[model samples]
Target: MNLRVPTAWFLSGNRSDSNYTVGVNNTVVGFQESEDLRIAHDVITNSILVLIILGMGCGITLDQFKLHLRRPTGVAIGLLSQTVVLPFASFALAHSLGLETEAAVGMMVMGVTPCGMMSTVFSYWVDGDVSLSFTISILSTLLAFGTIPLNLLIYSGSWTDKQFVIPYSSILVLVGMTTMPLLLGIFIRWRLPKVASVILKIGSYAGILLVALSLVMLSVLYPFMYWASWKIYIAAISYPYISFMFGYVVSALFKMENFRRRTIALETGMQNFTLCFAILEASFSHVTSDVMSVFPLLYGVNVRTAGFVFVGIYKFMEKYGPKPVLTEEAHHLKHANNHRESFRLEDQQTSKGFLDSEAAEENGES
Candidate 1:
């Protein structure tokens, strides 16, 4: 979508500096009430989510997923990191920081949710195992159906007074939204490889577009939100890095390979904001939902920025670090060249021998 909503909201002569308040009521009041925000949230989030899912499917293959399907260790570790370790970390961080209830709940929701598509994007760029990333993402998403509601019940008891119910319909929407496009992309890859390749290139750019779209949506949704509080920023900055390290260290402890470690790290660190938003919309009143959304929106931006930093570091290392070994095809080509050189040497020796024999015969005749 365009930035017209935010621009119009800005130009409508309703701008007030005092509207930026720290209270949850003040921060999210405009968002809950704005028709523009509701529309933008639905349109922008869904579109971006679909594109991300499609891109993820385009990059992965059935062959690459064989290990996850069989052994399930990587998927198990990844799910544990996200569902168990990350959520506990999120709760601990938020509680220790003494954040407001809504903010704390937001962090927990982000921690409990599935990994975002941006993780897969980062994995691809950083030369991690894309298949492993996708596998972990899908498996975590499937498991979130159970773990998310359970987490909400467990962590939200102190935060929310209202009865929390798991909204199965919204969960189903998340499943369909994520899985359908993924399956379609996989089908295209299997059947129409050329088409899938083109789509995959386009999908790589989805991250940038989603970021821009989110900024616009947030601008329109909460034109007066005071995001300047150091508390939220502290949580945002610390959470992703902690989650990354947690995944990496745990994977290493479990004897995962380097590439899988990187993939798991990214997958664990990134949370699916769109899915979290959807759940918020389904489970709470507009006011409460809007208040909760601030956490995910801010977290999404910060985490992706960190992810890109990871990508840049990896690109630099790939360019300047030790070079990769030759592939099987390269080895075959080298062997063929050596064989050709040997045959040429043999021909030259035979020609010299024939010339010597001719010279000797001629001398004998003389």
Candidate 2:
């Protein structure tokens, strides 16, 4: 097997003394490639750790989870879209694009992974249903063990010749990673709000820094992925957009309100790519793992970039777009927000007046 150093990898400045023979799949692949791969892998490992901590510290609360549960219908629909629609869409997309075996598996892993905490952040930004987003994220994560393995087995069965074992143990690790911190955070929020707030502040700063480092590592890795397999890039770019649209259509068909539909769309589109990376790394051979990582890295880049653009569009529409014809429920929520704003202003004015009177009293005494 000829293992050419991909043009992109070669273009990324040399960090080693070793020279690689292009197109030879020798056991001793170049140190440079190994070194780059190791660095990227380390970055991913660290980022996952940070995100786990961050998700626990700041991403959710037990109350938020319970609130979502109060309305099971919407949350159930979101879960269906996540576990059923997204994986099928990914499998179909990979098949249609003729992605490499490893790449196809990577895509399926990404599709099957739970809704990321970032979806809730986006939901809050867009005035979407935050409870729904949180609910979908938490429930999907809790159920990922069953859904992930089943989806992968169903979708990628054709591609692998060996009896590719789904590592149930690793799924346990996933459950622990996602749940332990989450429950701890909820506990902190409930009992020690001050401590939780401090943790949230620190976690946000650290998460941002680690995320920046991870992006840099991924950017370096991207060029090394095959130019010949341009289809992977096409798939990466299109997958999230399609997922978003699919969620909207499904939600609309279910006759959900507009905000709930948008919430489902964001949840469906944003997956836990970090978890995908962890699963592939743990389950596959080194070479196969490296190859599989390409799709996730590409997706991590594309989804967020595209999501941000969509978020901007959402914000613009909220501010300047024609008023949406509101249902009674929607009208009630709008009136509630307006009422809250008025109360806040009145409180501020009362505080200001009290402070002024105290100051005047002090001045008279002087």
Candidate 3:
């Protein structure tokens, strides 16, 4: 395989020495990419991906799915954010930052991918609507077949060369792999609730493990020079929060409840970087894939960190924040309780008076 340095290296004025030394500001970073290492990474990561999707599938039920279909506003808004708003935001960010062709394409790819299971986890942690989160997650993953290619067709032209081909076949394979496990999980949930519960637990742990492993592998495999780039770092750190903000704002604008807004925000922000990795691996050159991979790795770390912070803040507020006022139903219930207590007190007083009068009458008769 011919190894061509990514255009990002040239744009940043960095050069590769004969020994593949990547340098910036007199700092040297070096790493060798072997086929075996790539194969190992792919196998491990893909397994984790399957487990994560399966776990998420187990969380869904036909009832919850049909309920969302009946009330489609929240789901529709979430889909809009995931499919439309996110890609446009990424494209604008890339252009405004004046990123190189490869890096820009990476941004768009991350944007267009479906929402990850981590968002459902985050929604649960933050007191968001977990059911809505699950609903959006499965729906977005199923719809990714069309949305991924459509977004790429619309946005890739501005960032990619004419020779760049959209890997429709690879995309189809990915969609199939993701959906089949998800459907299987749903089946398990429907037929064997106990087994689905176990799988859900396993999947949650696997998802956390996947994040840790990805970070570690990225640090070891990718050159330090890529991490040192301020442009990529800024883009990665900002992308999730920006996407999150957009989701919240749009949902709020549509008058969604707080829990639904929170769910949508997390779904919008925490994208399936695993899917992005698979796409890059299958579609791009090795060198370019390596270069673009850095963005998602950095993004995965930052998004998780920010999500934890948000969860912490939400928990704190929920525990110590101002109490919400009673609703009409609660108010009526409270009033009824008070009235019942008053009636009990009156009955006790009347019984006491009658007993006193009866005792006087007995004394007079004696």
Candidate 4:
């Protein structure tokens, strides 16, 4: 049964004027900015990117990455699903749903880009395998640089009212900007574990705060994608959820452990929107650019927000739920993290006591 119906039944929208506008006039969407403003937004976004990179650096542990590598089956399966399955599924959905030309291509790009950093938090919140989620997110992001072009070549051939090209030079810029930062963080941690540990502990909240500030300040500077239409939004919101559900449900069918399933679910759901958005921002010289604009603005925001809510709901039920599906690997990992956290607390207490005692002794002598 073809389930396609008036999308309005489930979603909200009007289908007119999906194009760029000008002077608060034509509904067509384009960047309306003085060169100076454009430069400012770029500088500000880059600044935020730097903070995210450093924050991720502080958080990443090479040892955790190693453990992820050790479980080749999980990692391999996840990479395969993320790199191959999700993109194809998204392509199919776009075709069947008759997603707008730009939107379809955008979905393809997003599907292949990556599981995101946010998935790690969602994984933890849901009692999922944080390790597996991180591994998939990193590996998938790396793979997209290669596979996105292939997706364009294969799936995009039919959508050819216009030609789409990804400049290798631009892609190289993106990879360098995104991954190099994370890798640099890894290096810093290795070179100075003590310093890195302190950074990692507070990095998440601090980093997010910085980006939020940057985004607000730059909102006027950067012309936001105008997606006031219903048709455009339908494509934006539905695509991510469809792809995510495909991964989430399919992973469960394999009867994988609950934690693994949950991790797979969230990893498939979230994506590195910042990276995809950057690619779009750089390459937004075509109709595909419109797709790029809409997807990240709509798809990324909705999915991550929904993902976080799901994570929170799961967190509330965590202790109340059935016993965990901690495979031996995850069980050992949980124990290790607990032990490390315990020792950290103990060390802090001991250090404080020693300081207090020394101060008391000095006072007595005085």
Best by lDDT: 3
Off by over 4 Å in 1: 1-41, 223-228, 322-366
C-alpha root-mean-square deviation, candidate 1: 14.8
Question: How high a TM-score does candidate 2 get?
Answer: 0.70
lDDT of 4 by residue, 161-186 (tens): 44445445644565566567667766
lDDT of 1 by residue, 140-251 (tens): 8778778988887787776775565556675667678767888898788667756666676677677667766776766556553334347777888888888888888988
lDDT score at residue 53, model 2, on the 0-100 scale: 60
Error of 2 at 264 (Å): 1.2
- State candidate 1's TM-score: 0.75
Model 4 accuracy (lDDT, Cα): 0.58
* Candidate 3 per-residue lDDT over residues 1-366, each given as its tens digit: 122333236224466634345455755554555667657877897888788778766655455455466568889988988999999999999898887776788788988998977786577455465558877877888788789888988998997753444456655666676677878987886677667667866776787787677667655555442443677788988998898888899899998877678888999899988678777777786777766666776787788878877788778877799865644322332232224333234334434545666688689999
Give the number of the best model, judged by TM-score.
1
Q: Could you list the CA RMSD of all candidates, in the order they appear?
A: 14.8, 11.9, 14.5, 12.0
Kindly list the per-residue Cα lDDT of model 2 for residues 80-131, writing each as its tens digit: 9889988889888989987767778878888888887667556645657655
Where does candidate 3 clash, by residue pair? none
Residue 55 miss distance in model 4 (angstroms): 4.4
